[model samples]
Target chain A: MASRSPLLAALMRLPPPAPVLMAGSHLLTRLGRKMAGRHPGMIARLGPEAGKRLLLDATDLPALILLQAEPLSLRLFPRRAAAPPSDAQITGNLAAFLAMLHGESDGDALFFSGELSISGDTSAVLALRNALDDAEIDLAAEFAALFRAPETVVRRLAVVAGPRLGLSLTRMEALP
Target chain B: MMELVCPAGTPAALRTAVEAGAHAVYCGFADETNARNFPGLNFSRAEMAEGVAHAHARGAKVLVAINTFPRAGDADLWHRAIDDAAGAGADAVILADMGLLDYARRAQPQLRRHLSVQAAASNADAINFYAREFGVKRVVLPRVLTVAEIDEINREITVETEAFVFGGLCVMAEGRCSLSSWTTGLSPNMNGVCSPASHVSYETTPEGQDARLGGVLIHRTPAGGPAPYPTICKGAFTSPDGAGGRQTGHIFEDPVSLDATFLIPMLQKAGVRALKIEGRQRSRAYVAQVVRTFRAAVEAADRGAEMPVGALAKLTEGQASTTGSYAKIWR
Candidate 1:
């Protein structure tokens, strides 16, 4: 499994400015909707747990993310902003979160390694993790699809760039 | 040669385990029919069938775990799970409850039965009784047995024995712990979860990160440090030190998982037929890596080669592991 990316941490020495944050948040919101649309089974799999509000705190990033699961909405808040009320929170660095999202690292290993922190309603967090794992989301592919870019080229670029940049851009090799 | 029995919480994990060289993959339905019934985990009936077919296609067996005790006035649910597992083409059904075992024997004699570790059958007499009465072909020995004791039991019993070689170590006798139920009103034997996540919470207090189970503070880690899961047995606590003021520590058990990779050959020599890994609620990535590692270890043990040790330290709970009762170091 890919360890947490030190290169990513080094790059986040300065938080992104407000305009960039706004633009990224807008893009991510649309991406979240698209992902929910593309993988309806993931949401449905949560059963009665679809209404949970989860906080994703990337300790190295500029802002924290508050994700509302039912409507598939994602909103960003400055790291220093008043914390929103959430059912649960998962705190980790960007690389660890991305690696878990892309199946490059195991969530339990990350937690066991002290790279991730979990608080609040752990069952909701577990539900989200299981749903995301089943969905098999590929961050690189999701961005490529959202931008109408050719998936193969983007995938090749991600496969080449991901390691160097300390990111898990694409899904790990599928199990045979 | 000891078979590698891997756990799968989902169909994807099942496929991953089979591809990773598991001789047999164990799983359960998406209900309280088995332990590790965490949210969004386990398989539906259709998925179980497909998973069985997938594993079988790769020359691997699938064992469905309907291991939870059937609730009073709700045994039909457990009965249906057994029938569905058999229908899904399971090679065996791991069961713990006596009623369920007898039911499986009478209702589906063709389906093999493996006594679950939850039965806590740690001796030759109890194991032999289960084999004779319920036609149990294999018995998953509780984690409390030492290698010498296991060897002694093997000498007296006829059924194949399976022992946990890796993963979580219960502080109490398997299937008999009531700590979670006393605290949260949910028991693994009945509800299929110990320390059910719904009752667990964590917070960063002035002192440290506090983990609470059922609104009771269990563990307090140093500020910004990693906190272990709030299972009652693994929790930190404070109690009056008899004549003195008070003492605080993990009074029951430390937050460490069981890792017996170094004892594979010993367990094999003890007549263990299969080695079991314990995280059905873990991710597919975790399952794949662990199964692959144990497969190599099992193969090496067969070849009389040195087994890989400490390869899974990063994957263990609190990044710490113990040989558990296998070494009997306390004795």
Candidate 2:
């Protein structure tokens, strides 16, 4: 038989689905909530704060749109938000989010460079920085393990492609 | 007999080195306060305190590195690190930032402070300036200096000197490069992360493969070839020359580690106090093996025995090493 793809081989060897997804989703939710909570004031300013709807267009396959609030949750929003007016538009991919958190990329630059965008509240965007500064998300162990994982090829590819697409889209969006 | 200081990124690594005869083991909080801020590495405040106690019990000292520069308007975190290190019974604090060094010297006059290699004290004048102004007791010399330069520095300065003997190397002048900042906006001086993993990615493409960091294409290896990490200085790029020729491949350095094992006697004669081994991200097994090897070498040098042949060839990256600037050819 043809050798199973490396990623497939790795995934198949995983100890079943429920435990893996549960653990992964739990980590994601906890980190997302921690990030959101750390910048409560900023999170509040993004729309109504309590019920603000934000869209994160990852610009990658299996594109993700996140709706963030007091209790943070993530879902794949299909067909985009139809003129419903999002408080902010976080473009780019997971790498951009990671870079922004690491203080490597500023929100303003991300927005101006079209790596990220915002429409409803500029003050809300500023608040995001404040929140990140006040909060600490520990992803070192998780990130290290993820990098060492054999199935990391998919995510790694996305990390490389995401920023390229985001930058290109940002430029295209900026053109008249 | 000057003290031989070494690096330890984890508690297990610290204990391993201390047991294997490290006179001093330097570490940092599991955060940006240290240079080797790799994931799943470094010590917690409590762990540091415990490690200090253990090292002290074994007659070894613990030095804390708050080496990275403080961000603009965010000096409190750095200050807290200094206070925490002092409270944890650290033997000394290694610092790089002028402002932070000044702060530590003033705020805690009793805390012994050493200048970090990140400060890049390549010359005697700079070393003397830091010693005289900030009362720095020692200066970890940057890897760019030669044995003669180190001897010259010792002759001119009262402070002790330290140098790296093994592991990874930096080609750029420390504290000066902004490559990471230019691409990622996170300054290594301020953020203490170099070529942070968050911005790095490896992808397989029909046109071979690519490794990129922060959206910049750093390397493209052919299929079935090894892809080195996208460290900015070691990236492959095409620089068009004014003479209408283009240069490709590692404008700075090839993907190789530094191994200066053959230069120990020369370094000792040049008034070197400590020899550092990098790689805080390495396994405890790796740390134990390296510490044991170096410990034996140091002992052999003290007894005037013939130096042992190299035993760490397999541990080096890409199975290659360089004497780096210690031979002075680059200068």
How many angstroms is residue B69 displaced in model 1 relative to the true structure, after the best TM-score fit? 0.8
Off by over 4 Å in 2: A1-176, B205-209, B222-227, B239-247
Per-model TM-score versus the true fold: 0.95, 0.64
Categorize the docking of model 1.
Answer: medium
- B61-108 per-residue lDDT for model 2 (tens digits): 999999998877888988999999999999999999998899999988
Model 1 misplacement above 4 A: A1-19, B224-226
For every candidate, the chain B TM-score is 0.97, 0.92
Candidate 1 local lDDT, A1-176, one digit each (tens): 34445766666656667887788778998998888888877887787778999999988787889897787778877787688899889998888898888766789888766688788888899999988887888877788888989978888888888877767788767412
Q: Give the winner by lDDT.
A: 1
C-alpha RMSD of candidate 2? 13.2
What is the TM-score (0 to 1) of chain A in model 1? 0.89
Clashing pairs in 2: A39-A131, A44-A49
